[model samples]
Target: MPRPTPSPRPRRLGVAAALAVALTLVGGCGTTSSSGNLKVYQQEQFEPGETFSRMFDASVSQTCEAARRALLSQGYIVTVLRPDAINGSKNFQPGGEAHVQITFNIVCTDDGNQGKLSSAYVSATQDRYTLKKSPNSASVGVSAIGSLSIPFASTDDSLVKVASETIPAGVFYDRFFALMASHLKELQMDAAVD
Candidate 1:
């Protein structure tokens, strides 16, 4: 007869023990660490510097035309127009009793490549007006049956422009200049097509 085979229970126990020891030996070779070299950095904000493009390529006249388009796109009414300057205004009613407006004036340097903008200064002013409501009653002379009376309701602005503030030459101007740049590009493209 062949040698008696080992019991299945003992064989299974031996295999399990060997596997646990192997895992322990393999795992013990590596060191666990908590501290890491990872770094956290915040994003840099967009700051308009002194050299920001207030003056750019294109002529004063063409740039003014581009400015007109830009302002119109932004719902501004172009009031005064000149070869080297533009003035526009936008209106807003934030509340039922208040009316606000912003006036935009852009003056471009007149020296450039006939159609290129060399330099420009843009200014924006914010003005607020309030609405007033007053009640008045007027009585006419007695009529045949009853006295004639009229009540008038009116709301009017003081017609005074007040508290105007000029916008700074920072992000607002940067954005305006960027839009003007794009508009100038478009004008060029349009001329090329023509």
Candidate 2:
């Protein structure tokens, strides 16, 4: 007599249980949850002139001009220049084959006091890059073998961006505002003398 065959249902359930546990453990290894991270946006208080902005007692054009001069004084390459907006970028090497770039964006607008009062809003972003090398590969055709692919010892190097963050409002912005104020003052003095 042939023995009764065991049911496949039990074996299937065991496999399903093992798969569920393995998936759970693998999911927990992630640095962030599936819900993602929004702490940066949530932390913003949006207080007026707290960090990213300052008010100036001048016209919008004058304020933007001052911002331009301030960025140029710091050796930043001005990329965009306008009467009400200015953008500049500067590069820095902090060693270890790492590169950093800081880009400044400024916008000037009237402060509801006709053309006498204006506000200059500034925001800066810092981008960090690292050198990445990829090995060079060559594919050779041989009569015996269909094709053979080989990697050479030589590598191609490139800058790969790693991290980017907005510069928080602090001493960095404070010093910028101070310098801009001095430049504006000088411009006013020059105008008065003329």
Candidate 3:
């Protein structure tokens, strides 16, 4: 009788199998924490004409409030304001040109299996401007993703930082707002406001 031949297993196949098994086990191991306790502190609305101090305070307040509401939906315990006062500024031109600047001082602490993790963050001066008003205010859609070092902090802080740092103050007014205006009629017909 002729000798029976055995099937050969490729080296790559063995390595790939091991990698997949390792990834599966690692992915299933750790539990992430819930971000249900963050608090937000809003300053107040800063209009175009006001003392520099008051205007700045209002800007910080508005930004903090907006950030807080957005973050809450994602399950974060955020404190929008610091113990010390923050400063902000907003400028508006006659032809619907507007500029805004906001700064923040933040301190946060959270507990996880690795131990308590705390960080102090200072996000300084996010400025934006708008040139034209939108006909359909609802058309403006702002979204952010933020994340902390904690196991379950799902928010991507990098997005927030990018929005703050890179977006020009008045680009929305010139572009996004204009788009909203052109689409207002259609938007109203299709959507109902509460």
lDDT of 3 at 144: 57
Off by over 4 Å in 3: 1-96, 108-119, 133-163, 166-194
Report clashes for each candidate as comma-separated counts: 7, 0, 18
| CA lDDT of each prediction against the hidden true structure | 0.75, 0.91, 0.36
Question: Best lDDT goes to which candidate?
Answer: 2
Using TM-score as the measure, the top candidate is 2
- Better candidate by TM-score, 1 or 2: 2
Tens-place lDDT digits, model 3, residues 14-129: 89999999987766543322443322222233554321211111223232333343334434444444433322333323333444444433323322324222222223345454
Those runs of model 1 whose alpha carbons end farther than 4 Å from true positions after fitting are 1-53, 111-117, 143-162
User: Relative to the unseen true structure, what is the C-alpha lDDT of residue 6 in candidate 2, on a scale of 0 to 100?
Assistant: 100
Q: Please list the residue runs of candidate 2 whose C-alpha ends up more than 4 Å from where it truly belongs after superposition.
A: 1-38, 137-154
